[model samples]
Target: MIDYNYVLRNHILTHNQIGNASDKSNTQRCDVCGTFLSSAYALKAHLQLHSDNSKPYTCTLCDRRYSSVHSLRMHEQLHTGEKPFKCEICGKDFSLRATYKTHMFLHSGERPHKCVLCGKRFKLSSSLKMHIRTHTGEKPHNCDTCGKGFSTLGNLRRHQRIHTGEKPYKCTECGREFNQSNSLKAHMHIHTGENLPKYDISVIIYSLS
Candidate 1:
């Protein structure tokens, strides 16, 4: 007589053990990119970036090469100085349509990206992703020069100006320069006598009361 139930129980236990072992092994993460993969095959695919010989897509103008064709196309835009996508509202242009679409959100105030945890809305998915980091306390962007960490890449880029001493924004009025545009605008207010937009607050107060 065959003990079918006992045989099935053993088989299930063995399968669970194998799954647990596989999960534990998956904890081995890539040191270079910090990517975690479940299997050896996936890990090997990710580690291809560490290999210098595997960059198949090479840029003709620059020494930069990528493993994917899509990345190569994006890099080639810098060499060609191509601005194919144009905005209908502001007449501004972008090299990629995705960039132009994101820019359109600024004029439309159309915040489509919403946070799943906090119910907060953002104009862009990148903004939503950065907002999520506030809850997680994850500062992934780090400066190699100072070992300082920032929550967003924009903040990190601004911080790098301190090390590089780069003042990119300039005021046309006084020929004053600043590392950021907001600083230049604030300085401009000194000359322009606070060009703040006038608004009637009494109507809003009466409605609220």
Candidate 2:
């Protein structure tokens, strides 16, 4: 029989020795896969992939998150939510630049994605893939909080907030609640003196009663 207490003590001592060896060796590891991260910043970002606690880069339209600020800017259309990218044929609106590019094919009558099962065509490959998933009944995007299903990961992310009650956007002036930061920014104009646009007009009328 082995002395379990002695073995545990020895293991702890060895782990402490290794930890104190150098700062370069004490990198953060992935909790799930044990992948070593190079820097603390990278480790912090990698941790966000696991939990819904952090969202540094927020979308202006719907308060979505991305690893980079540029991605948030790209996601802003869901709010100005302006869908400037219009389909030439039916005038359908799309927030994504690529989706708009794909919609342009409607005017050209181009079918890029061909279905082998039913001889069908699609303008975008992603749409065709989603359509195929319907035949297979594939629902990969699921909400961890409420056990709801979504077709896209983005939709699932948006739904998860209902359970977490995580409203990251807040008005700086009045502390009002908003789903998106852009809305908070717009609300801030109420405090700033820029709420109304300037217009000048002069009118003179003479009437006899």
Candidate 3:
């Protein structure tokens, strides 16, 4: 099972980022479900790959469609019940592979994506692209309303809410609304009356299953 909260956080942090630049990748693959997205901007619309809304991939076995092919495959697993990620080398499937894949990068010491401007090394070409922007002062993401610039598309959308007065996030308990997700999370404390507990993301994912 996917820890949706963890996925949400990752989406909030990395949704503006595209595929690793040096890798010549186009997809912002979901870290949770391995769904390939052509654009980083589409992450929110997919709802962490678990939402019922806007599902385009349909299962021929049933009426259910899903936001991603990965999701559709997982759902079809309910009928057939097989699963998981195959290691590229040995071809053994694992329940989880994100950290394992990163570990391989470390084992090889292969951070191929380097910034030409600063000699900074990154495992992801996306990170390298973002780093390069710091030197070039490029703001590819711009606000249509105010003509303001942001380094990332996520930041641009977040800023746009100020102009539009739109609040998409709401407290489930109090029904109070907020323009940002972080604000909604912080407001949730009023109902719980405690600080959120710190749990390893793996622990949360384990509980979800």
Q: For this target, which candidate reaches the highest lDDT against the unseen true structure?
A: 1
Q: Each candidate: what lDDT?
A: 0.71, 0.61, 0.65
lDDT of 1: 0.71
Which stretches of model 1 miss by more than 4 angstroms?
A: 1-55, 66-71, 143-146, 157-209
Q: What RMSD does each model have against the real structure?
A: 12.4, 21.9, 16.1
lDDT at 179 for candidate 2? 49
Q: Evaluate residue 129 in candidate 1 and report its C-alpha lDDT on the 0 to 100 scale.
A: 72
Taking all chains together, each candidate's TM-score versus the true structure is 0.53, 0.33, 0.41
TM-score computed on alpha carbons, candidate 1: 0.53
> Which residue segments of model 3 deviate by more than 4 Å?
1-85, 88-112, 116-121, 195-209
Give per-residue CA lDDT, model 1, range 1-209, as digits (tens).
99875675444333222212235655547778765555566668778878877988889887798878988897788779899889988899898767888999899989998765567899888887788777655566789999887888899999999899899988788776777666665566667886633334542232223
Writing each residue's lDDT as its tens digit, candidate 2 over 91-165 gives 788888987887688678899887554557898898776665554444557677677766667667666766776
Clashes of 3: 4
